[model samples]
Target: MSSLPPASFQTPRQIFAAFDRGDLSRESFREAMNEHALQLIEEMEEVHQNPVAAWMEHLRSRRAAGKLGREYGEAMVRELLVALSEVPEFPLARWIWNADRPHLPLYCFLRPKAEPVFRIQKIVCAPFVVMVRVEYGSSEKSATVREKFTFTRDQVGRLRMSGRERVK
Candidate 1:
């Protein structure tokens, strides 16, 4: 039998790195990431329904062990609640899990050694694309950093975050 959280949790980060290296095509990257995201959301829903399940216990242990970051448990609860109420702008857990690089600005849900507040520097809305410049946060190895998030409207006009890159 396979483990509850599946060792494939790190697959997205590897896929993203492959895309960065031009080893994977953009379409393939999007497809793989979206599939992985759907799987994670399904698991989150399952855990939400059965809070005391074994999978939940495994996740709790991971959080306590700092395998998933300090604020992961709280963030997961918040994400589940928001998901129950409405669709989120982006997959918060996915981003947080993949943000392992020292240079990358820490996700809002994470509490680094020194917590840095985020500010929305700019937002440009267009017909099909929306660009947001966010001052994300500082990490232990880096100073304050800004990131550009690109969201594109789908067929039904729901905006989905497609890309995140460090702002120069």
Candidate 2:
């Protein structure tokens, strides 16, 4: 189970004020953000199990070509991650930073290091430059990774249509 900060904790505005005033250490702010992220993950898991169950059901329906397209997008993201992991760290960061890419659709994997629980699914129309974060609860450790593979006009044109029109 993920542990969250107490409800009486400072709000984002308050935290930002402290940060701006140099009253809050950067490390403390980071830890707070990590905690907030874990809480969000917990909430998302709840929704995935219930309120969002309909979405999963829709994934099985006959009119799910959009979902199929999302699956393909996810496969592309996985391939990208695998390729990124192969590159040396510094060079990969430099390349990603310098690359002018547009946002592509994505699927994400969230695994809890302390537990056997994991979630994997597609995100529709997510920006390519968005941050990806991995958190380890036991050690209160986290890492973020971002990619810069935006789709060019020509690349968008090459995407498989699957009878359904591309989402604008």
Candidate 3:
């Protein structure tokens, strides 16, 4: 009954535009972003090249060409830069950026109208444990978040997070 387009056929930019125009519900947009992020993670895992760096450069070019708004473009660039630096851990980093962050996918929701910037302060990857320290927020307010995750392989041999906790 809804008028929303199929998320599988739309790019993240298209989904964002649809949400901005009131054509897509908030929850739908979130799901679409999740799907897109997952697909990107899978693709990044398969590539041997530095796709993350290429992606960041592409974003910069898009911003330079005025395809994306200034604030939104800058914010995305910052987020992608962090992901690029994270390399083999880029999948988890990208997931955290897109899925773990509550206020993402809707940049206009920030109270003070400042674009958020994301930075990964530390990442320690052990045998079955991952600890990441990240700082993200707008100029007005920011948060340093640390998360620990224990991972294990599933029956199908796909790596999965067995447990996760926000470290205080």
Q: Residue 78 deviation, candidate 1, in Å?
A: 23
Q: Write the per-residue lDDT of candidate 1 for residues 1-168, one digit (tens) a residue.
A: 012233344356567878999998999898888888797687567668766764545544344335333433333323222221122233233434433344543233333222332334455556787666655344333565667777776788656677778887
Compared with the true structure, what per-residue lDDT tens digits does model 3 show for residues 27-120? 9999988987786675456443656654564454444324323433444433433333333332234323342243553222111211234334
Q: Cα lDDT of all candidates, in order?
A: 0.49, 0.37, 0.44
Q: Which residue runs of candidate 2 sit more than 4 Å off their true CA positions?
A: 1-5, 52-168
Query: Per-residue lDDT for 1-168 in model 2, tens only?
Result: 333234345444445667889987999888765765675587568656675553543343323334434555545444433333222331222112211133432212223232222222333334332222222223232332222322221244332212211121
Strongest candidate by TM-score: 1
Question: Judged by lDDT, which candidate is best?
Answer: 1
List the candidate 3 regions with Cα displacement exceeding 4 Å: 1-114, 139-146, 155-158
**Per-candidate RMSD, Å:** 13.9, 15.8, 15.6
Better structure of 1 and 3 per lDDT: 1
Please rank every candidate by lDDT, starting with the best. 1, 3, 2
